[model samples]
Target chain A: MWDTIIINPFINLLLWIYMMVGNFGVAIILFTTLTRVILYPLTAKQIKGAQAMQELQKNKRYLDIQEKYKGDKEKLAQEQMKLYQELKINPLSSCLPTLLQFPIIIGLYQALIQSIASAPLDLLKLTRHLYPDFLKIPDLIPLNTQFLWMELGQPERLYIPGISFGIPILTIIVVITTYISSKVIAPPPQPGANDQGAMMTKMMNIYMPILMGWLSYTLSAGLALYFVVSNVIQILQYAITGKIYWGNVFPWLKKTEIKKP
Target chain B: MKNKILTIFIVISVLAISLTSCSDMNSTATSWGGATVTDSAVYFADGMQVIALRLDNGAEIWAYPEKAAANRTFLAAPVLVGEQLIIADAGNLLTSINSRDGVTQNWQFAGAKGKYIDSPLVVGETIVAQNADNSIYALDLKGTKLWAFTAEHSFWAQPASDGQLVFAPNFDHYLYAVNLETGVLRWKTELKASLVARPTLVDGVIYVGNLNGDFFAVDSERGTILWETKVAGGVWAAPIFVDGLLYFGDQTGIVNILDAADGSVVDSINVESGIVGSGVIVTDGIVFGKENGDIITIGFDGSNLGTKTVGGSIYSNLSINGNLFVVVATKGDNPLVAFDTDVKQSWVYTTSKK
Candidate 1:
């Protein structure tokens, strides 16, 4: 049960590959690349649909009809539907790929947690480790949750050597990374758009980064590692797709972008 | 418009196919040897009913609601000894119902104690019931109090005996060896880790692991530590001994084998998932449940023998009779399932069905 459900097949393959490569960061990068490749078709369809919706929004007559029928909910819906039909754009076509990625991402996160062997209570029959079992080293922190002064299993807390500050440094990094990732891909708001849809989009743009950052801090470092790698990969993907991958895109500007949200 | 209908049909067809494939992917794993050679029909709490199935033919003989009412719940497995079926209820009541008629013959534990016994281990004439209040109560076959021993913490591990002394590990990081007759603590050794499952005893060596992933081999009589090995993950399930090797599943999905004599690492296999409870050893084969609600069996050479997937987590030990295994399977999204070891559709029983 634990193996079949929590230890997802994708994570297993990636971990197996990680063991062979001896680098988790590299494993995450490769895994994300493969995931993006698998989702390419869906994303392409969504991008095309978004362009069509933008094209439809350019019609002033359709906008005027919507404004006039706004008081009548049924007439407004019919007019919107008619406009969508004329433009050949599906209203929700842009959401499918993003929605489909939710379960996969969740499964990936679960797999990483299970792989790190965290939360021993919820894990089943895993008394031994898949890796090397050190007999005399339990005295110095169980399993190496630390790498380069960062506790890989814990969110980065401010440590003063003699004091327990518990300040979440990793959370800050997560917030910054998520902000940068969203800024790189977020669609620009249309001119004279309805306030409700505009507000929703604005709220999502602001809140989603904070949510991801909070999750990065609260969850295991395996997930944090995933997020960090994912953000880097997304940035790289954007650069490549935008035809700007040949040279360094202002490193100074990238740092500023990280601080946006 | 035609495309819209086609899209809807495609969506519905995809959903139907996925659901059917998911159901069809249901398979069986290595199960406990649950079928007993005895004459009395065997029954364990599955979901809502106590399924009385023939041990010989694996046929359902009778099915009854496990509880008296829809709200009543039971925690312990229904133990069939002679003519009686001993079961523990939620209100800390131990009822010995007639096996043939399933009637109330004897009821013990008058008022509400902390919580009822999680599971009872019957050794000879004495039935050792571990209460949630960290006490082990010994009851005679007639439901009379014999003696009770209190541990430093709650006792989750089942008590095992060498036909003389009862060894039990508690949450207080100590394993106590008690005299079964007088309920006297012969010796207590601090393990530095909480024991969650019963220790596997082979020959005179007691092998037990802790929540800290430390496996120890202690001398049964002297209460002396022979050796200690640290696993990567904490062990929640009891270790099983087979062919001079000890096997234990931790909260992680790794299955480790250690030398029964010196606590040396023999071999390790990752089942790609964590196990939920201790495994049942049948000769060279081991069968256990995982937290993911799957039953897995492994052979002596670290080979995957079989697997059975269930809907709920497996919380009980597998009762082995012969080639057949019996377990309290919480199948589907529902709360109860009493099925054969083969994961066959025997009957669904719940504690709330009555």
Candidate 2:
């Protein structure tokens, strides 16, 4: 009874929102904002870890210690742990916020699929009874899944007749903002700039957008909209705290210098 | 970092605006087409507009645009009453337009707000229709309401009439029978799943399919289940009665022939695509138009009759006029077509209304 009355209806309400909004992209963004605001403390701890990682890079003596212990793998691990402890930094802090988003992602995905007209009946049974027939479009198609030039059920196709609506201009903005945020907030590379970590970051920087674009192409347009919107919102939140980078990389961004207390 | 935040803010502003703006601009495409065939011409509900075509040459006679923007699809094949074409829009209103010029005769019936979803069931001098909220209404030929009855759930399928009783399937998993004239509840039979297909009345039995993939024959007088046979897929398509046999297609693309007398599966054949609308037009020795977005004409011996790849799901039921079979396909580049038993195309046209 509770499943049908409570849990079922709540899930359906979210689906109703997706149907009404017509884009899963916007749905994800709104969901991210609400979650981030709720999990702000955890995100703040992550930022602190990032700040400490940056400060640790500035320690020349610490660099020497790492180099001296580098050859002895076990000893290097101990030394790194010691160094992290001394700096009051936790490595897990850096990944906690990202990991937290997983559950929300699954929930949002379930909600998006449920609201569609073609979704199976069992899955749709999870939907709430808030709007009994909210997504029931007349005649031709049963679900109102159209957004922009793209079908909300399919990936973003960039073509705007004379202009390119490709990759969802909004989604592109999200990726760019996410890239900029990483560059601004992420700690600078240490003396060993060609290290494995640096290589991984470079790979990530190139691969993530490509992956998002590919996903945008195959998956629902609603999801792409969500990614773009959430990235943009986080960027704004970071900017409020002066954590955003306004460096030469993005010459257009307004620059602000950090002054020590 | 600042640049990242700046970029993020800029992106969000754009996405938010675009998302909102895109939704405003994202009007639903009316891909569904239903035609009301008359002696002079055929009236079609194309998207939000009503288009009239000459029955002889399939030429455009007239078009009524923006008649009902409620997204109440014209799925219940158009009903022609004298010179008026009746179609339901989004359950809130039922419109009767002049069959000749596409002029509005009556737009909204008073207190008919449950949102009419099914096509009006024309019985004698009265026409009956069901709404999404399970309200059964009986209206006169001129769109005047005589009586109405509400059931336990929403109504997505068209109502079935057997002269005396109106069998309306409700989303609440019930097959309800109300008197045609008085709109009084006669009897109700609860099922395990929601009934989305319109029932076909044969003899004294109401044969209907449910969401749980079970097709049953219910006694019209007692509202008791006589026999139930499960199909592989949910029956979204209404059952079609040809002669003494019941023919219908399930969502799994299987065409089944039921006994109609005992609710026994007589013959079942699998097709390439899931059956969209109910199977119709059994000609000479062939059965056709179940699924695969194609006009499949199959021999009674279960051999391939003739197939035409019309890329789209069959959303509209087959309408037969003499030797011509009309089937409206959904989600296709070309949505409507008329063909003879030989599989030769009589006329084909595309409407962007949906």
Candidate 3:
């Protein structure tokens, strides 16, 4: 079911885009951009839902309920639910969209791997997934894996003269972009909110980039390219929404308090 | 609070990684290693070692390296040159070992940047090897680089030569003819689809098939398509020519027998399973192993001589030495099985690992 619904369509669409552009890297960027565009509304809703929940933390009634039912755990939960309903906030709204996007990310990764088809068996398996009605397999196949100095099928490395080892240039880019995207999309540290949630988020902000970098360093350059492009697009999306907290990424540039008499 | 969101993100990331790991995304073994035979031994690359089995009883003769390394993989069929066996690994290293004991390291070639998918062709004093890096390296007897012919795509099929020009089939849907000595492009004939199987060069003509179900007979002197015909399915194995007839199988399990003079289907037999490896011509008939673990023998008149189930999908071409016909399966208790002329099971060689 996953192959039929997600992987097959994604592979065919990627091939179609590759056919039109004649470049695999460009096709990846375009396909990712198109996916983000299609999911724009859900992303917007998710952002709004998260912001609303954040705002609810500062609400007077919400805080009163927390204090009033501090002694009674069950009562506190019921009051919180009532308060959420009154404010027309759904806690799951933000998470549902994120969960929905997970399949796309996984599907795209699988599709990219299939489309590359570096090995003989990989190419043979790819032939079974191709939709002849949608595109011509003969013309699109042996997809131009070469993009700049990197072969999209292999891990990217930049070889320089006299250098003993090739540098992981794409991995570095992926790490930086992932770090920046995580910080940019993160809701700014709520004043005096030293909760476990905030602590976990901070930890994730560090570990996620390292994990992404490690994956990029090990996996195919095409997937690393996808990660880099996805991160950049995410950052751009948050920036466009006027919700990006650049101060989270650049602490030195954060505005200092201007005390006046 | 926001902790739920963080927790969900963490869970999702872990799930994605777990799912990706479960998929075939990181698989390096593309296909089963083909088997090469001599008088007393049958040599093949199995996972981390090149194994030699006794031809008569399928007993272990010797294995190279002696110890298996987790980082190394040998998948291409080992080509025997004199007393040495040339083995290509997935690590882009080609090494030649003494065939007698599989201990002495003859020479190693580490110039290619891609994995060696097919066995290198030994033409006189030159070793012409096809690499997934889109180049064919021509090395000398001492493992010295001589010349290389770069193509647009990776080569899955081994190159055929007429002692002068090397005819290489590429995944770019072209059959390139390169000079055996200088590695110069003689001519490249564009087929309808990607060519995965080796082309059959007989007399002065090249017979090849493509993934588009189109078979062609191209003039070797000048790269021109003489005749083309559609088959039942996409052809993944090279066509075998015996006498004046050419026999081959397709992805749809149809074994086609055609006239070599012109591209005409003389007779065809449906074995009900896909065939990825070319068959060998036996005295009784032609023998083929299907993807469904069936070993089939068909006559020149398209009659089924005999059939036996080997219990694993056979991907490597059937290797025959004397009356022993060897078949390598993708998975089974007995991965390597041999048969006689009557399609009777001779011996089975079990792989070390599952």
Candidate 4:
């Protein structure tokens, strides 16, 4: 079911784009752009939901409930649920769209790997996923694996003259872009936000970049390119919405206010 | 609220990590181990290490590197050139080891930028190797590169030669005929699809098949298509010629016996499983290993002689030395199994034991 619905379609679409562009790297960029564009509405909804939740944190009644029910943990939960209903807020709204996008992300990664098959067995498996009605496998095959200096199928490295070792340039770029994207798009903590929330945000801010960097460092350069492109697109989306918190990435810059949708 | 958010992030991180790890595991070289057989022993390259075993009882003689190197993976069959056994790894390094002890450090060829999938073709003093880097490299016995012929796509199948010209089947949908001495393209005949099977040079004609199920017999000297015919499914194995008949299998698990003169199907037999490896001509009949772990023997008249189940998938080509037939399988307790012309199992070698 996953192969028919997600992987096959994605692999065919990627191959079709490669046919049109004549370059695998450009095809990947175009595919990532198309995916982001298609999910724009969901991204907007997620941002709006998060903004509303952030605003609810500053509500006087919500703060009073926290303080009033500080001693009674079970009462606190009941009061929070009642307050959520009174305000017409769905706590899961912000997470739902993100949860929905996860499959697409995973599918796209798998499709890229299948499309840039490096070994004979992987290539044979790739043939099973190709839609013959939509693709001319013979003409588009060997999919221009070379993109600039990287092989796209292998881990990216930059070899310089006199340098004995190849540098993990793409991995470094992935780490920086991931860090910048998370920091710039994250909403600044409200003045009275709980310390726990702040701590969680801080943990995510650190963990995400490291995780992305490690993945980029180990996996093929094609996926590292995807991660870099996805991070950049995310930051650009936040910038267009005027939701960027540049102050988080660069302390000298003033933070932007979360725009009401 | 904070706990839920943390939990969600943690879940996403763990899921992403798990998915990434899954891909990483799958992305490692997926080709099966290739084996080469001689009179006394069999040399097998099983991804992690290359081992030479006695042909009689499947006892290990020696393994290269002593301990398997994590960075190196060997999938191509070891090519025996005099006293040295030449093996190429997925790490883009080709090493020539002493065939006797498998310990001596031989000259290594690190010229290609891509992994070596097919074994190098030894034509006298010249070693003609096709690489995944879209180049066919010719090296001397000492591992020094002579000349390279670059193509539009990679070469997965080993190149064949008729003394003067080398016939290389490429994924670029072309059968390249290059001058063996200068590494220059004499002529290239374009096929219907990507050619993954090695071309069989019989008499003066080259018989090869493509992944698009189109098989062709091309003139070796002129690169002109002599005849073309469609098979039941994609042909991943090379056609073997015996007397006046050509035998080959397809991905649909059907074996087609074609007349070598006109490319007409004389008979077809369905084995119910895909055949990726090329078959060998035994004294009794031609033997082929299927993807379903069945070692089948078919007579020259397209009759099923016998079948023996190995219980593991066989993707590598079957190797034969005298009366002994060896096959390497995946996902079983024993990966290397040897049999005879009677389709009876002789011995099984477990790779994990070493």
DockQ of each: 0.04, 0.05, 0.37, 0.45
Report every candidate's CA lDDT. Answer: 0.62, 0.63, 0.83, 0.86
lDDT of model 2 at residue B316? 62
Residue range B219-305, candidate 2, lDDT tens digits: 988899999988876677677676667777776678777777777777887876666565556564444554457767655544566
Best prediction by lDDT: 4
Regions more than 4 Å wrong, model 2? A1-261, B1-32, B66-76, B285-291, B352-354
Q: Worst 10-residue stretch by lDDT in candidate 3 chain B?
A: B22-31
Give a tens-digit lDDT track for model 2, residues A110-193.
455444432223222332223435433121123445565756554556665676445466456556755765566554466654
Of all native A–B interface contacts, model 2 reproduces a fraction of 0.00
Q: Give a tens-digit lDDT track for model 4, residues B39-108.
A: 7689988878899998888889999878987778888889898898999877688899999999997899
Compute the lDDT for candidate 4: 0.86
Each model's backbone clash number: 40, 29, 0, 0
Worst 10 residues of 4 chain A by lDDT: A252-261
**Pairs that clash in candidate 4:** none
Q: How many angstroms is residue A225 displaced in model 2 relative to the true structure, after the best TM-score fit?
A: 19
User: Which pairs of residues collide in candidate 3?
Assistant: none
For every candidate, give the share of true A-B contacts it also has: 0.00, 0.00, 0.34, 0.46
Sort candidate 2 into its docking category. incorrect
Scored by TM against the true chain B, the candidates give: 0.78, 0.87, 0.93, 0.95
Cα lDDT for residue A114, model 3?
Answer: 78
Cα deviation in Å at residue B5, candidate 4? 10
Q: Which of the predicted structures, 2 or 3, would earn the higher TM-score when compared with the native? A: 3
